[model samples]
Target: MMWPLSICVLSFTFLMILALSLVSMGFYFVMNDLVYFIEWEVLSLNSGNIVMTFLFDWMSLIFMGFVLFISSLVIFYSDEYMAGDLNINRFIILVLMFVLSMMFLIISPNLISILLGWDGLGLVSYLLVIYYQNVKSFNAGMLTALSNRIGDVALLMAIAWMLNFGSWNYIFYLDCASHSFEMTMIGALVVLAAMTKSAQIPFSSWLPAAMAAPTPVSALVHSSTLVTAGVYLLIRFNALLVGSYHGSILLLFAGLTMFMAGLGANFEFDLKKIIALSTLSQLGLMMSILAMGFPKLAFFHLLTHALFKALLFMCAGAIIHNMKDSQDIRFMGGLVKHMPLTSLCFNLSNLALCGAPFLAGFYSKDLILEIVSLSYMNYFSFMLYFVSTGLTVCYSLRLVYYAMSGEFNTFSLHPLNDEGWIMLRGMLPLAFMAVMGGCMLSWVLFPTPDMICLPLYLKTLALSVSILGGWLGYELSQGRLSFNLWVLRNQFLTSFFGSMWFLPFLSTYGVSFGPLNLGGSVMKSFDHGWSELVGAQGLYNFFMLNSKITQSWQNSELKTYLISFILWIIIIMCLVVF
Candidate 1:
């Protein structure tokens, strides 16, 4: 039954991909007639004007291909992982629903349709997260659902604002782009929506928590579904978001997210949680590069990140499966001896993740760094770029060290070899792609040889950082030196660029010096006066006093009702007299 169902799902996915590819090709040849491919409805106010439209441009096609390809891999991998699970049927359904929602989102014709798909993805993702129905998984799902609702509200508000301005369609909105201020505000709100969805900054805590989901679900969500939605949203609105103050804000946020996430990954002990943080960091890098006005680089990085990250996560799942579902790296060591194929796949994916030269991650990530370096044309942004790259190397090595390089810790329960032919077969292609995907970029996206020049220095720096970080990690694992503790303690330094717990309160109310400070005196007086007026408890006492007064009035219910009726009658009489 499982085998047949798996075959059916793959067939459906392939057919869908083929159909979309043909449609995309048709749009390319009949570019002038692209509107015909979209489902358009005439606006009531304008007989000939359509209210909704979808353009099958180069960008959408590329993203569509990514969605289809990654979804295919996820479904294929799930076949073996979910083989004996009784709820496998529901799992397959949710997978299909999730993929369908993403397809709709990518080709959405208007804000309404985009939001429809957005909400659908969120709904399915929450279900997938809590599939095990365990307490921790439920908690993670609830948090994700709540955060996603915040984003949904922001999106709906933006859509409402746009509708009030009488332009809900992208074409009309773009045509009237001269209202840069209004567009900028909408863009900012949309960025908020994207930030929450992508797990950026304050909203980022939800993602690592989300690792409570099944590994395959985590792979899909992290790689191509929920987290990447933000970058895709920003890319879709590139015209409005680019060249504005909001763009700069996004760039800074993205850079900060990348740095902090990388640092967090280094500090984490759970293997899945570390990869989850890495996903957040890589998504941040993609968004930052997109903010630099290089959509192609962003898209390219998105593609590469999906391939390697999913492969790594699935391999981790295989490891967990073999080790009786143990997720702690402390118990995992020298499994490379037993699961050599899985280890090799995992290592190759990590190499790509570390952006080693000629690998998939190297091409895409180096391109982003190169673009930022050239376009910033300033020493500060350049330095920021360099530091971010170095941190990326650090965390990628941390992931490798904690998982694959430790001494084989003997256990009462011995780990097994690879799961089966199905799991190994599913992982093989991802490993191959991780190794060779970079070479395909030139032929697929950029045919210009000049655009393909390697960033020799950046690659060298990344390789050096990876080697040093890995060596240091290994030594620390073996307790060669006591210095790694200091580095671990200083993890907060990497995240300091974005911490605001103290600053917001301090800025909102004037900062105070000593007891003699004017600001301190003013605050003290204000506190005293408030305490005297409302009593020691302040607002709670005031609310209690009000409640007592109301209770006293309500104690005489008959009298109170008579008085209320009289007032109402008098009000009605006064209206009649007027």
Candidate 2:
């Protein structure tokens, strides 16, 4: 008992201390414009050198600080969230391993080292997702793991491609990579890897499926760690990736991802899945902005989004915890009257997600929108951006309406109140950061503010759309929309939007259906059919028949010897007479 309690406390304390130290170091590195690299040579090939390298710079340190900070709070929160589980120790240890993997990924600029952390993340996350030991959890884990394996394979291909550059250390090659087609190919592979990791476009299904994991894992994985790894990777590779045709390709896919997720979240009813879809939406935002050649802005939003999304998940976890593990929003209402603190935190994070003024999301998300408007882009990309932005607000407010407001729809005997001090403690810091993190990050990340010279209508477009989105969300949630008739009449349309345009089906059944059938056919035709007949079974029968004939000959050997002796005597006598 004591050991379990101490593990949580010790991890929280150590991570908090490390977080503070890393943040301070990050600031110092930024002020001095310093970057330090430490390398240890492992192997030397004819063309490529395998080495482990650690990079320390402002970006890496700051990102590490945030990851550790969020992880500490989550571990602290999990103490209460997972209190009754038999394998609490295993869960905590897995979370720690997860953080360690992210840290390894954050500081390593080399492809080989990146792959080390990348694979570690995939393996650990699959374990964590399947932590519940249910069939649904198993399926979700398989989807998540298999989806990430695509990225892992891409990264491995990138490593192989990097061999041509004589070293897997890619930091030294960024400047010259733009001039070479081969390096461009490497960049394309890296982007493909990023797309899978970030859950962009066709790879989007797993993020929502991964909600089968525990809430604490969802908060941690969805916020600062697993999903953001790809965004961070792209941020590091921005120089090599931006301005190329690959950037345009990334922009297209990312735009579709944002639009898709935002729309899906609106139709989603499951509480965690809605939030999961929101995470997917934000990931799309980060990726699209990164694809648009604004890595810093993307990084900025990534950090702020992490703070608020973590808070949101924590609050959701608290609600679900008290509701006796009920996660359907329709069963939840008047939570604000019951769990005031949790409701406040949840609403605050929701507002921040909508990019409300002065909130953490406002600083980065608004800036990204403004930058998007100012930049030259095709109409399709432009429409996807703003429509997606509105949809973000729409689902956020809709979620709030369903889960927070209206009548108390839960069981009359429920004990739903914000009495968990440890859970609240975990949420409070994130809530504060969710309110102020953007402004603070903006100041640190940008010494001089970005200058925007858009027209008044364009400048206010984001806020305008936000307000419009909020209204539509409220009305739609209330089932007061004339659009409801259309939705009701066209169940197919609703299903299409609700099912993420059937992407989950496509990613799972659609992808596996052919291969599974092919495997069955191959098994029947080869293993059970021709291969069995012509190989082992045929050989066994042939040997058995031959052995039977040999045994018969052996049994007749005495009689056969008598007959042969008589014949030989007759033949010898006849030859002598002749």
Candidate 3:
């Protein structure tokens, strides 16, 4: 505990200094975006342009700074949360490596160079996800790693296709390649790659499963850095994605991702998983808005979501740790009585998540709703966005009811004190930010988009949905939940949402099984049977047999001559007829 605690303090200090440096860089880059390259060709080939290029625009500067800030705070928080574990050192190292990978991913301009950061993120996240070494942890880690591997492969293919353009500096070509068939293909692939990492729609199962990890890793990786990588990629390449078919499809998929996760959260019970689904829901909101051509808004939401979401998870981690590893909200009623501070942080973050006005989440979420409303969109997009907005409030209120506001559900003799000041100290700053970061960032990052001409009804639709959702959650969750016959009759619907619409099953087995079966067939028919038979030995045997037959025909005996004449006559007749 002493050594781990000391290292955590040192790491926090170092990160704070780095964050200061990034803050100055952020201010400098605001007026003008800067790109720098250290160029000395490492290879002799004409195409081996292995230069380390970095883009230090406002986006990367602000994002990387926020990542460091959250990471340092998370490490400080983990000092108490993970203090009892035997491998605390390993956990801390993994967390720091995860942060480094995210930083590397944020800065690199070249696709090939970006792979260094991308693959590092995947490998380190897998290590962090499986930190506990249990069966569930192992399985979840594999799903997380493999699902992300799909994105890695997509990125590699995109790189290969990009090689045709003579350089991998995609940032240089985004404006030029707006409608290039090759760039369009790369753009489509980039979206797919982003989806898997961010856990959008069909590829979303690994996110909740990844909660099998320790909670700090969840707070750091899922909340701020790893999941937002996809959003950042689109933000970086917004020039190419705008007005493309791929962007439209991204909108549809993102809406479903948002709506499905919100629906899933309403049915979920695990405290960590509930938060995980909420992260998924917010991620969907970001992607959907980005699809609607508001990349800046998406990036804004991504940052704000990170603030409260990380705090939310930290509160969950504290509660879970204090509750002796119990995670089910069904067994956690009246926790506000025992852990008031932690409960306060949890509720505030939850409210922010619900888009309560003036909080961090409200700024970004409210702006997204307004801009999305202004757009000319299909009925499906409108329904998905507004209904999903309502669902966010619904699930958040339900979580509050079950976990914080009722009779105590744990043992009467349990000592349910606030764990200590150490935990609360880490949470207090985030709580402050979660409350105010949105208002602060709105002025700094974006010009308040002009909305003076909008109708009153349009402006309040999101808030209306949120209120309706809260009322429904408060009313429906309190009484006769299991006994509701409409719910009983619609067990299939309940089960479907409860299972995250079976996305895990589809992402894993549905994608893998057919290809694996076909591979087996190909190996057997080609490797062992046909290729063996027709390859070197079979061809040699046929030519040698023909050589022997020809030699026999030319032996100059009477029988040989008669046989050759007969064979020639038969061959000539067959040629004439056919």
C-alpha RMSD for every candidate: 8.1, 4.6, 5.6
**Per-residue lDDT over 193-287 for candidate 1, one digit per residue giving the tens place of the 0 to 100 score:** 99889987667767877898888888889888888988888877777766777778878877777777776666566889878878988988888
Residue 321, model 2: lDDT of 98
lDDT of 3 at 117: 85
What lDDT would each prediction earn against the true structure?
Answer: 0.74, 0.91, 0.87
Q: Which digits, one per residue and each the tens of the lDDT, describe model 3 over residues 413-468?
A: 87677866777888898999999999988877875456534688987889899999
By lDDT, highest first, what's the ranking? 2, 3, 1
What TM-score does model 2 achieve against the real structure?
Answer: 0.93
Ranking of models by TM-score = 2, 3, 1
Clashes of 2: 0
Question: Which stretches of candidate 3 lie above 4 Å from their native place?
Answer: 3-5, 31-49, 447-449, 481-483, 511-513, 520-578
Residue 180, model 3: lDDT of 89
lDDT of model 1 at position 30 = 40
| Candidate 3: C-alpha RMSD after superposition | 5.6
- What is the C-alpha local distance difference test score of candidate 1? 0.74
